[model samples]
Target: MIKWIIFDAMGVIFIVGDDTNDLLVPFIQGHNKRILKKTINEVYLRASLGQITSRQFWQEVGLGAQYPQIETVYLDTQLILDDGFTSVARMMSKQYSLALLSNDVSEWSAYLRNRFAMDFLDVFVISGDIHCRKPDLNIYKRFLKEAGTQAGECVFIDDRCKNLAVAKSMGFKTIYFVRQPKKSDFVPDASITSFNELENAIENICQQIIERVIFY
Candidate 1:
């Protein structure tokens, strides 16, 4: 039985702009998306893992001189809680353990916690705290250990197919959240575009699992 529901923070619980584009990309004058993406990716893991401060990260990208201004723009970036998902999470907390597993920088994560009320969450496995990001087997193992639950007893929901694929391989039921589906080798057990479909998808999965157990 699924005793826990693990949620990804960025695209799932919190809406960060219209898409997952980098917050600083647009604010940077004369920016090249390709080079910017490459540069950010190079240092993103280390920054998310809390090995360096956000200022240090921008410095590595050669934006150290404009770090303060970029930081202001980044902070001003639109980010809001998905009310529908928050409501669902609140309701689900009564029946199942609810957790947040996110890849985020330490300073921003702290800012989010202070800005939002997350009392309904039973566990929070943040990459900044653990120094490991998703799609990394170690992070998932850490979440399992912290939550005190087996992989089979959890349902993992993420907006990225790659992340879901990793969770599925680790034996956790996976759900992919996206607006328009594209072809992918990593098939999710369920795909949802809106928060409205989430509850039903989860229910259907649980029902199917129960039926299989009964049959065998």
Candidate 2:
């Protein structure tokens, strides 16, 4: 029986909703300014996965040009957690072995852990610490080793198609989270725009597995 549910942070747990693009659009549009450096998404990921320090990341992206004036905006823009994250996490803890598998840097993951106090999580794996990122099946294999569970017994949820495909290939039942439901998309084991929908997904997965086991 499926005994665990693994969640991806960032896109799956938090919703930024193109807010970064929202900020950059105005400046470039008004001035016809060329984007001079790495995209904010790249810089954010670099810092988030521990490839660079936050200061170095911000500076490289020209946030240092404005210095203290935009420090708050820069930091705030990168790490906005979605609403209802903690509540859903807490609720899921009651049912399955709730785990978070994130490709994040040391500092960013620390910030998120502090912000949410993820005491409810049974396994919190961060790629920065392990020096491995997902979509590389090794990371998923490592998680299986650490959790003492086989891939077939776990459900992996990620927003990235590449990552989800890897997990699915490794025998995990995969869920692709959509930011909003569309009229057409290959249905996942379940797709949820919000954390509130997670419990029902878990229950459905459990029922499906149970039926399969009975038939076998």
Candidate 3:
């Protein structure tokens, strides 16, 4: 029986807009834009792993001098909540253990926790905090340990196929969040585009589990 519901933060729980570059480009646009972009991409993984501080990341990206301005611009550009997901999460928290597993930085994660009241969550396995990111088996195993649940006893939800694939392989029931279905070898147990659909999908999964237990 599934006792925990694990969610991915960025694309699933929060909308970081269509492109993150849209948020940062305005603050650091110049002839060195391409160079700065390359630098950011190179350091992003390291930064997310907490190998470097948030201040160091901004500095490496050439926005160190305008850190405050760039930070405001980035925050203003993205919507924190992904519409109905917050309500769904709140409702689900009452019945099952809730966890957040995300490839996130420390500063933004701290800001998010402060901006939103997510006290219902039983575990928050952030990449920066753990020094590991999803798609890495160790991270998923870490989540399982921290969440205090076996992989088979949790439902993992993510917008990325690669992340879901890893969870599915590790015995988690997977849910894929996408608007349009695409051809992929990695198939999710459930696919949902909107939060309304997600609620129904989870309900159906739980019902199936109950039915199986009763039948056996």
Candidate 4:
């Protein structure tokens, strides 16, 4: 039986998952159009890997003077908590363990969690803290370790196929969360376009798993 539900941070929990792509690059370019998007992304990669502090990320982007405000103005201002997610999370948390696995700057992730009152989730495995990112099985392994659960006992939800693929390969039941309807070839054990459908999808996956166990 699935006893845990793990969510991805940026896209799945927050409205934007790839914040570097959706938030940072544009913010940097807006300030200095001469700075190539590629360069901005390179610096963001370092920040997401914990190689640089959040302050250093702003400094690297030539916004050292604005570091204090950038996270609020550039990141938090643009990112939003997905509608209905919190309500569903409240209902589901009573039934199953909840976790968030994210590829994000450590400080930013923590701040966002606090800002959005997302500390309700039982566990958070951030890439910046661990110095690794998703689509890498290592991160998933770390999540399992931190959550104290077996892969088969967890349902991992994310907006990215690559991330889901890694989790599925590691014995997790994968749920593809379609937040903005991007094209994807990877199929998941289940899919949810909105949080309203989340509980049903999770229940269906659980029923299927139970049936499989009975049949086998």
Q: Tens-digit lDDT track for model 4 on 43-114? A: 888998999999998888888888788767865677878888899998899999999999999998888888
Using alpha carbons, what is the TM-score of model 2?
A: 0.77
Which is the leading candidate under TM-score? 4
What are the per-residue Cα lDDT tens digits for candidate 3 across 78-196?
54687787788889888889998988787777777667777778898989988988899999999988877899899998888999999999999899988446678998889888888
The clash count for each model shown is: 0, 3, 0, 3
For candidate 4, list the clashing residue pairs, or say none: 10-16, 10-17, 11-17
Overall local distance difference test of candidate 2? 0.72
Candidate 1 weakest ten by summed lDDT: 17-26
lDDT of 1 by residue, 83-200 (tens): 7877788888988999888998877766766667778888888888888888899999999999999998999999888888889998999988884466788888888877889888
lDDT of 2 by residue, 139-211 (tens): 8988998899999999988877678878887789888787754454334677777777877887888899889
TM-score, per-candidate, Cα-based = 0.84, 0.77, 0.88, 0.95
Lowest lDDT sum, 10 consecutive residues, model 2, at: 24-33
TM-score order of candidates, best first?
Answer: 4, 3, 1, 2
Scored by lDDT, model 3 comes in at: 0.79
Task: Output the lDDT of residue 149, model 3.
Answer: 80
| Models ranked on lDDT | 4, 1, 3, 2
lDDT of each: 0.79, 0.72, 0.79, 0.87
lDDT of 4: 0.87
TM-score head-to-head 2 vs 3, winner: 3
